[model samples]
Target chain A: MTTLTREFTKGLWDEIPLFRIVLGLCPALAVTTTMENGLGMGVAATFVLVCSNGLISLLRNVIPSEVRVACYIVIIAAFVVAVEMLMKAYFFSLSESLGIFIPLIVVNCIILGRAEAFARKNGVLASLADGLGMGLGFTLALTVLATLRELLGAGTLGLVFGERVLLAQPFGFFQQAPGAFVALGILLGLMNVLSKSGK
Target chain B: MKSYLQMVLSLSLIAVLSGLALGGLNELTFEQIQINILKFKKIPAVADIYEILTGELSSEERMAVEEGLLSEKRYVDLGLNEPSLFFVVRKDGAPFAVALEDYGQGFAGNLGVMVGFEIETGNLVGIGITTMSETPGVGTRVKEKAFVTQFMGMSKDAVLKVKKDGGEVDALSGATVSSRAVAQAMDNARAFYTEHREAILDAVNETPGGSS
Candidate 1:
């Protein structure tokens, strides 16, 4: 449906979770250390987002208005727990590396924000499209930041998952905390530039 | 009125479903999680120290050295189980040394340190830091590979003091508290070894077969 397409496409640019809406930042900053970690976290978050959004929308008519927030939280927390457990079982090393961040997903504002703002008012099918769009948008933002950081910091790209595509031989500072700030600042600046030019 | 009751009932049902789904997943994955935690905990301090001593340890030696690192039990025998540390000494797949990790109340909190000695020679083989939560860029310098490397081959009589105190070890810059903590931890390890020298030697003689 045209309505479904609009809802989904809006999340990709106009209502982007990180650059535009500016939600779900804790994991954004913490897990953007490596491209693999960023992608892993993004996908995990997306899975929760899509599931919670669809489920919440389906139950929107049933959930009492007074207790909607609590209901949404319970729904989001359940998805987070499921993701955390799955990661631990299959991707033990990554699960350990991500550490406390996985549990912290329960508190990520993006899932709850969509549930309340969009899913509560929208039909289940439309809500699913929005969830998918926002989730992809979040993943894209995280991946871009992480790629910039990892390439600059470690002097190598794709070093995650035993792959290497060298960009620069050595950029040691990129691997440090200060480098994280620098990369993020540049990305934000570039996003602003692109948006202004488009407008 | 009927619609309100239906809404409440539906929300309750959704909550129950979510709970059951998550509980079932957790139950399924609990064993794998436990195994991962156990492996993480068992990674021995000796392996880390050996890598420094030999520079790039063979995987087999690494495993052997880890096996040699006694678990917390040996410290229990010394009544030091309150906060115990264990070290295993290995020579060609046989454990010939036992090191104990100890923590001394330092400037910020507990300082984690390891001391290793050759059972036959009573010669201190190595000392290292495993973990510490001192002030970053300051107290953390104590755990620097350079700072810890100083403990190699030092005899029991070698006073483990910062150079400012007229001893052999250099105190970490701006982290005298952490430095002192390491020195004290070493001293405690020394005292424990001296008191239990016979048992330690006996355990070392048992070598590869001994329970670490």
Candidate 2:
């Protein structure tokens, strides 16, 4: 794969934001009770991540090294607010579903981590791909987690493609805080097993 | 000295540019956002409350009120943290019912509650949970009909408290924070109205299109 494609694909698995890097667990644990919610949160974070990443990378040189982190936060927060307004106006339902976490995206370490580690050094195009990759990775991990939780917790998996209810009556333990912890533990174990086999 | 000047100038320049961008975006969407919140979240609660407040009004009048048969929606600022919105449905030039937006500090975070109230009497007609960060299935169950419905027709004269601390409001099992947060919201709704009853009424009544 070309280096550019590699930047985009790495987030799919290798440096997956939630699992591989273990970043942005707060929203993952909080909003992933349902597949739809997980997707909404994931996509919202991705929008902020991509836009903020591109902006920071473009302005990286203009920002002083000592105040780079503060500049990143301001830029990220502005984008988050803009995203929040747009969501509230147009995607009202999704905005309601995501709730406080939309604003909390300002605090999501994934966005900041990218700005500090990758965006600051890379060109805008490369940083955009990285942001898109990592954001999608986070989204994938969340959706997988939410799918399990919803199937188990609510006894129905309402996939957003016309909300086809996959299972009418599934396990209920996968829906709460304790359920989130247990589910994460199992998924991490599964990841460990898959990685061991590949090795 | 040169490095410090660079740091100060660069960060401020970034802040100013980003602020402009954010401001432009906010200008585009903030109006629509307000409309969305009003039409979806707050209006439903008002309609529900209007049902109970209906005395001698015809079904036509009831439907009109439910369909936001009002001329204007008033936003009130107690000048504290942020302004809370109030919707007063007037009939025949008299205030029929009032919906007060209330905020409470939840265990997880802040809670946004819109409460429908009877104007003449302080009875709670209905409620809408606008925003909450309570844990799903556990604390969030407070938003369900089983819990919020219990407050309907509740006399605002009484203090809103959870059963755990010796009030009539039943606390959700293992979700004390969520329950208390709701109670706090109710307390805010009642206190704000009681303290500023005249001003709230005056503001809405003073506005045009509210005459009988």
Off by over 4 Å in 1: A1-6, A158-179, B1-23, B38-44, B50-55, B58-89, B98-148, B153-212
Q: Which ten residues in a row have the lowest lDDT in candidate 2 chain A?
A: A160-169
lDDT of 1 by residue, A1-199 (tens): 8988999988889888887877887888877877888888888899999999999999887788877898898889888889999988888767766778898888889988899899999999999999999999999998888887777666445645455556547575665567666777777788899999999
The prediction achieving the highest lDDT against the true structure is: 2
**Which parts of model 2 are misplaced by more than 4 Å?**
A64-66, A158-172, B1-4, B51-72, B75-84, B90-95, B103-130, B138-188, B202-212
Q: Deviation in angstroms for B130 in model 1?
A: 5.4
| DockQ, model 2, C-alpha based | 0.73
Per-residue alpha-carbon lDDT of model 1 for B139-188, expressed as tens digits?
87886677877787788688877788878878878888889889988888
Local accuracy of candidate 2 as per-residue lDDT tens digits, B1-212: 99999999988988898889888888998878877776677666566555545553576775677566344567565676755457876557677777777878897788877787777886777676877877766888987778877887888776688888888888888888888888888788888888988777767765633322
Q: Superposing all C-alpha atoms, what RMSD in Å does each candidate have to the true structure? A: 5.5, 4.7
CAPRI quality level assigned to candidate 1 from its DockQ score = medium
Best by TM-score: 2
Q: Give the clash count for model 2.
A: 4
lDDT for each residue of candidate 2 in A1-199, tens digit (9 for 90 to 100): 3887999999998899778888899999989988999998999999999999999899887888998889889999998998888999999978888888999999999999999999999999999999999999999999999988887788666665444365566556677678899998889889889978998
State the weakest 10-residue window (summed lDDT) of model 2 chain B.
B203-212
